[model samples]
Target chain A: MALKLYLDRMSQPSRAILTFCKVNGIEFEEVKIELAKLQNYSPEYAEVNPMKQVPAIVHGEFKLFESHAILIYLASAFSGVADHWYPADLQKRAKIHSVLDWHHSNLRRGSATYIFNTTIALAFGQPLNLEAAAEGEKILIASLAKIESFWLQDDGPFLLGNSQPSIADLSMACEVMQLEVVDTKDRDRILGPRKRILKWVEDTKNATAPYFEEIHSIIYPAKEKLQKLKTMAAKKEPQSTGEPA
Target chain B: MALKLYLDRMSQPSRAILTFCKVNGIEFEEVKIELAKLQNYSPEYAEVNPMKQVPAIVHGEFKLFESHAILIYLASAFSGVADHWYPADLQKRAKIHSVLDWHHSNLRRGSATYIFNTTIALAFGQPLNLEAAAEGEKILIASLAKIESFWLQDDGPFLLGNSQPSIADLSMACEVMQLEVVDTKDRDRILGPRKRILKWVEDTKNATAPYFEEIHSIIYPAKEKLQKLKTMAAKKEPQSTGEPA
Candidate 1:
């Protein structure tokens, strides 16, 4: 039986897994669990994943949740895929695991908050919380700063200096790219200082190319909607009295 | 040169790694990083792990951080350790990874918050934030409830039906055990209803035995201190009015 993958493209990890499968030519049936509709709560889906989060998989009799875990499992189960994605060299792989594990508490935290509070809210027509957005911006910036100072400072472009992107690169770059949906000014202010990180993001997208674009295409509609909301909101605001103020 | 591990017993992940090392008979030099003393910020330690977190390791020229990553590295690098701890069986290992990754955002969040706000604050003579403690307790209780309903429903004693404890068992048990330092009522309220989870906790401790106790010994003093504070506070409170006013 072909592997069964449960995903929702709105999630960063979900997109990462979809892109990974496409890039590696892994055969799987995609089951979309739309978060917007809360379809993940359905009983049938709960049996497959009690956690009801996306990027879960069923391979033969095996079941797995957590996108990174799924990624590791896929790399191990399939032959003929590039080893750099999850290297066999113990130290190199350990380095990748380090980034993957660290990601949940760091980059993932900031990116999700920044996107949800800013872009997702706008797309849904929910009032934006400026206070929360500012806090999220701080976290996002600090996280980016850490990546620039530590992970990206290694020789060459990718994390751990590999010429090709690893699962860590795919996972983290997807996380950082969520900043694209944030208001342009807010996004630039948060991501602008990290020069190496910006370059790495472009490098990863270019390397992953068609698959990355294909998986990420789902977000474009939401992004455009958010942009339109911003334009509308800006027009509704009172004009500033430049001289008096 | 021996593998060097930097850790502090007060941190749950640090204790998990320490216990894993002891159980697996992995030879290493323990370098204590006293978090309470702010030693992790020192330049010397920062060179070892730029993230400045405990439970980092250096083997020969290779360096790794993040406790889960370190756990996976140690399991692979050391030969003859029990397979069930980090099983070579793909399905079994994937289940373990699922728990480990899920832990950081869920169980770890609640337990860490509960400890820091209630016990750690009392130990440091800082005022306890009742509001935050309540929120933490809610998260902790919800996380425990999920574990009981899903993960612990297996027929066997351990997670995923393994007779032996895996790294996930060690990591999660250590996290949940942080409730020991919380105020008696708060701890009871959070952990009391989960009978199966309590038994499993005992089972994991017994399976891992001396190492679990030995690694967790550091928390005893803090636990005792918190107990005294609770008792003293109880005595200082005004006697309840005999008649309903």
Candidate 2:
């Protein structure tokens, strides 16, 4: 059976997976789950992923969720080369694993908040809070700087100097791309004031552009609308208690 | 050069790494980094890990951080057994990997906030937020429910059916043990709210008691002080940051 992928382009993880599969010449049917309409909470969709996070896969009898896991699973199931995609040698993979883990809590988590919060500001007619925006920018820069100094300093388009991008690039690229959906065209202003990240992000994105293109249409428009709706929802209920503010 | 494990016992991740090394008979010098005082911000440490979260290891020239990454690395490096510990098969390992990843964000994160806020509650004079105590109960129960429905049901005594515990058990055991440090011992209330989870926690701790001895010291003090300091801190800060009383 050909593999089936569940995705919503509005989600960065979904885009990363879509881009990766397309870029690597792996085949799959991409099924869109519309988040703007709350399709993720549908009983049918909930059976696939109770957490309702995106970029999951169904391969014959196998079911998988979590983008990092999906990225690795696809790479392994398709390519059969562990080399640097996720190195087979003990320590190199561990470093990749360590950075990947950090991406969620520190880099991705903080950056997502900055992007989402700015979108919130745009929707609500509120100016972006300088303090929160500044903090987010600092964290994004620090995280990117780490990637630059530790992994990308070899002066190549790819993160680890491999001709092709690794799962690390996939994870980071999805996050950085989400910044583009923010209301402001020049998001790096809030990301880092006069940031040094432009060079590395350009290189990383350019290297991974083919993958970026595969899922852009579905996710891009939905993400724009989600920002507008979020502001509306916030205005209706500022501290709606159970709803994530 | 022998493996050098860098840790601070106060951190649950550090303790998990320490416990895994001891249980597995892996030898290493303990390089303690004081996270409480923010030693992680130093430039030298930044050279070691840009993310700078703990349970980092310097194995000869190699450096690894993130407790889960370190655990997976140690399992692979020492050529440990496949059955009870980290397995090699694609699906089983992926399930385990996914849970550990979730734990980093959910259980571990909730507990970290619990520790910080409770410490704040103690330092600043205020009534312990019953809401915080409630939040603690909520996350832990949700974690237990997932384990019951997904990983464990009839397979008792441990997660993944190990006569001896795996790094999964070690990682979770460390975090769950910190629950004793959580200010609310309102077991009757929380258990009444979520009965199955209460039983699971009881059983998980009971099963791990054999190897759980070394960690009891750190856990006991933190938990004990949480209950002890609740009143002390309550005296310092006002309760209900929610609204003006």
lDDT of 1 by residue, A195-232 (tens): 89989988998898888877777766777777898778
Docking tier of model 2: it is medium
Model 1 C-alpha lDDT per residue in residues B83-195, reported as the tens digit of each score = 98899887788889898999888888778866776657655555556555655667777889888888875779987667788999989998877777776777787788889
Q: Write the per-residue lDDT of candidate 2 for residues A1-245, one digit (tens) a residue.
A: 57989998877888878877776778799888866556778898777776676767888888888888787777767864446667776776787787778787777767765665556454435444544555466777666666656666464566655555678877786777777776554464555542334555565567656556555655467556856776676577553222234
Q: Which segments of model 2 are wrong by more than 4 Å? A: A80-82, A120-157, A160-164, A192-196, A217-245, B37-47, B120-141, B155-165, B184-209, B225-231, B239-245
- Best by the lDDT measure: 1
DockQ of each: 0.67, 0.53
Q: Worst ten-residue run, lDDT, model 1 chain A?
A: A236-245
Poorly placed runs, candidate 1 (over 4 Å): A121-131, A227-245, B122-127, B226-245
DockQ score for candidate 1 = 0.67
Distance (Å) between predicted and true CA of B122, model 1? 5.3
